[model samples]
Target: MSSSTPVWPAGHDRRVLAEVDSTNAEAARIAATLAGPTWILALRQTAGRGRRGRAWNDPPGNFAATLAIPSGAAPAQAALRSFVAALALADALTQATARPEAISLKWPNDVLLNGAKVAGILLETTGQGGTPGPLAIGIGVNLSHAPDPGTLEPEAKAPTSVLSATGAAIDPESFLDLLAPAFARWEATLRQHGFAPLRRAFLDRAARFGEPITARTLRETLTGTFTDIDETGALVLTTAKGPVAVQAADIFF
Candidate 1:
């Protein structure tokens, strides 16, 4: 990493690794002793996992990183970090590709480029009870390479990459340099204006809103029309049973 890369927030510490099991796990290990925020970047991950414990195949030279921040918010509020991180990632991608119009945000925390998945965000937290401890925000972007569309998990969207979408290669380090400052700005916005403004911004760039979709929860599956997210950041699905506020689920369009 270059010394001139960009300065992070005041209490933020950054670590770059050649390889790791998972950046989120590494960030959590450090968060145990560190009081402030810590950013972890790995060149490659042997055992990266995504939402719902899905395997994240992190090839070398792609972007894989995690940010762990100590938070005082309740668990539901802390979960909102996923949206903030998603907005920041979208901003970074727009700067990298210089095509602001091609980038869009999917519900929850996925970033899409030309209707394909370019990046995904995973948010995890520590501590017990309603109030949580540190929150780990994990982000993975397909920069130089993307998996074959046929190889993606059954429910995952077709994947794309920065190189494929823009015909310009982007390395992990350079993407981090672009991402850190963007993240800091969005984090500040969230702290100041709360989720209303952030929610609006997210919806502005949201993909596939008001479309028919299926949401599969642990208990049952519901088919409904896609609707807006509520004040608490839950996905509101208008099903035959009426409006359903889904806190967590696998969605398909």
Candidate 2:
């Protein structure tokens, strides 16, 4: 970390690129060579992707970054970092805009501002020589621009930018300064305590809790009351059938 303007977190590496194909791709290419956790930020991404292979519309002023952490945890445990990243993202958004009340987290890695989509998270693992690899936490924020709603898939949340939503014109680098440290703090909490604390924290900021929401999986779509997140970070929905725990799905509200 650099001790310069926009004070960065200590014990972590930060690399800011003028442009890249994608921060997650860059992180995967450099994951094996890193000696410690590193944050990779790309001011512009020519080829960015979102969950389910959707294109990420990263305008020049928006945020595109990934935190590459060397990890040895099991795949299930590693996947839980999405929640960890979500908590950090919420914290950073609250700090940046000074509107904590406006920030809320959507399930399965989406951040909402004023009940609209403002940011998203994607997780991938990179390994070499059959050993456990680094976990890349890719985050994209609509800092200054958002994609047109017509381009979105059906039932996808409408997108909104920080500048438009709250009149906060935060640039990518300055936003990274806020995100990296906040992520570090939550990472420490996950390492020290467990998913219990993170689950509680995520639920506190969770959007649409106790409300009707629909989760779409590959096989079927399940609509139920958003009740809780379980011990393993599964979304617990109280459907008419019963209490169903969903491990992976696209949640819509």
Candidate 3:
């Protein structure tokens, strides 16, 4: 793979791979040894994972990547990457489009364009206790196309793509160029400022307050109304059982 620099924060190591089982998997392999920030950028993948062991669909022209952060950044702080990466993805989508306000983020990790899933983020961590020894954040964006809606997989209930929705082809490198800088800025902010501002910014983008939605997670599925976002980036919802805080859940409206 030809290496053009991706705007990264200090101590970040970028590895461009031809193929991988999964970028998150690869990042976990040597994360115990690496001291600085690092990520594996993959152009293609034979196999990839999604949240809760679901399969991640990786097509060329979309961004499929993983960022490995230090192990010490975890427990309560582990999920910080979701907002950090989502903010960058939001910025990336804006750079590629004339209309940026149309691009907003769904809590935890999903990029929405016109209220459809254009991209998804999956974060995994390894460590004893609550703190993560090393964190792997994998992302998949729909660049060239979203899957056929008629014969779509069950896992892709809300799958949408930039090209399919917009009907315009976007160069991956150009999109990445826009995303990397934004990512670098947010990463720094995440390390220093924490998730409060990120959560607020994300909520400003998520204008679907009190909207009836389906909530699915690693365990069960529930229908709830979108209420608000908490400081740690939990999805706050108003359910029949009253208010609930969800650390991770699949949101479908």
| Candidate 3 colliding pairs | 71-133
lDDT winner, 2 or 3: 2
Pick the lDDT winner: 2
Clashes of each: 0, 0, 1
Tens-digit lDDT track for model 2 on 146-246? Answer: 89999999778999999999998788998998898888888899989999999999999999999999998999999999999999889999999999999
The model with the greatest TM-score is: 2
Q: Assess the local accuracy of residue 91 in candidate 2 as a C-alpha lDDT between 0 and 100.
A: 83
Q: Clashes in model 1: which pairs?
A: none
For candidate 2, give the lDDT.
Answer: 0.90
Ranking by TM-score: 2, 1, 3
lDDT for each residue of candidate 3 in 1-253, tens digit (9 for 90 to 100): 1134455456677777888889899988978888776767788876888777877777777777787776566467767778888998887787676568778777767888887888888888888765448888787888887756665556555678888677656766556666667888887787788777787778878847668877788898877889988886788888899988888777776
Identify the superior model by lDDT, candidate 1 or candidate 2.
2
- For model 3, state the Cα shift of residue 123 in Å: 0.7
Worst 10 residues of 1 by lDDT: 1-10
Model 1 C-alpha RMSD to native: 2.6
